[model samples]
Target: MTSFRLHKAAALVVVIIALAIGSTAPVTARDSSSTSKHVAKRIALMTSQKAAMDMLTGMAAGRSTFDRSQARAARKQLIRSTGSIRKHFRKPHLDPRSNAQPLIWHAWKDFKARAGTAEAAAKDLNTGSLSGLRRTLPGLMQSCLSCHETYRSTPNSFTTH
Candidate 1:
């Protein structure tokens, strides 16, 4: 049982990256429309990540409360959506794509290791006990953050001013 803190840290990094992009505040004169299917793919990735983030928050809250049923439900959503979340990443880049530094594929084995950590965290989450989740989610979030650091830019990392 790895520490949930690690996972929590990872997830936070990704969340920060997502925030940096905001997926709002449209860029100027980029002609995003001019792009082919890649633009659509990026949009889908954004949506997918947002949904997953929402679900993960719920799971995190449920963790401390020992809400087994809630944990179970969250795990189910995660199991269904994890592939799509990963799928979103498996495409050509466009629209900044969260400052993904490209080292993700460059160090594919390390990337896979992070993914594996997330998978274990997910399994621990399936235990469906708030205590189990509380015990696990931190590490899970950490795993998420570690990977995102290499793949994305921290959201709101800079100010418009």
Candidate 2:
């Protein structure tokens, strides 16, 4: 297989692994100050997602040079981060530092499905060509938008779905 094919296969495997990880219960460390740890994880997850989106959108829009290796790495990281979303968001009211709404835990099933959709879209993204990237971007963004609309809050207030 070509490098593109190999990367595609690797992305699929990563998505599958992520789904498995997200479906299982998270093993959290319950220390006296676990709230701070959860807040940190939330920050890390947001940063990872932002970085991944910047890379992907940059490549798609011709703003960044397309690098298959970098794409593969970003895709893998995104899958891992999405896997952590369920685990990280489990503890509600853990921190005032996040824009994550309490609605997340209330609508857990919908949130998990959205994460799964993003993982599957990441797996399906064919960065082999600009056209392929364009084709895949919408699916990925739609998944993100759906989750953000339903579960996340803005700086001012929580968004109602």
Candidate 3:
């Protein structure tokens, strides 16, 4: 009878210890699936931006014909993408491979302001004439450069400033 009681007490103690350890175990609060989706969205948005910019650059450099319709389409895409770009940068979705710096969330207001400026520049681009586009190109380029200088971190880059 005494042996039975001793064994029961030892089992109870072991169970209690296990419960305590289990309760204290680190839980992953982050939704990795959601994070991955956000990362993918961000990547797609950036890729689209690059594609649109490449088209613009090709026209500016005279490597491609200055098609007004194409320029307008690219400009419109840029304007639309600005909204998606903002959406994908939500604070909770951090990806290690992303070139987005933490400063984007830290200075979200400034980031949004830059995004707004970029959108406005895209809207302001004049696709009617080569000279008109040349005039507006600097503003669009500056908007891109300004954001990249502050918020983007390139692979192998030592600095974000």
Over the stretch 1-161, how does candidate 2's per-residue lDDT look in tens digits? 23354345434433443455564523322222566455555655655576687888899888988887787777777777666677767777554345677877888888788888888877777767778777987787777777777777763221211
Which ranges of candidate 3 are over 4 A from the true structure? 1-32, 155-161
lDDT of each: 0.51, 0.65, 0.69
Off by over 4 Å in 1: 1-67, 84-86, 155-161
User: Against the correct fold, how does model 1 do in TM-score?
Assistant: 0.56
Q: lDDT at 81 for candidate 2?
A: 69
TM-score result, candidate 3: 0.73
Candidate 1 lDDT over 1-161, as tens digits, reads 12253244434444554566565743522324433234344344434434554555665675333455655666664554443445545554545433455666677667666666666666666445545665666665666566666655653322211
- TM-score order, best first, reads 3, 2, 1
Tens digit of lDDT per residue, candidate 3, span 26-106?
A: 232222466644564565565567678888888988999999999988888877776556766865566544568888888
Q: Cα RMSD (Å) per model?
A: 9.2, 11.4, 18.4
Q: List, in order, the clash count of every candidate structure.
A: 27, 0, 0
Name the Cα RMSD for model 2.
Answer: 11.4
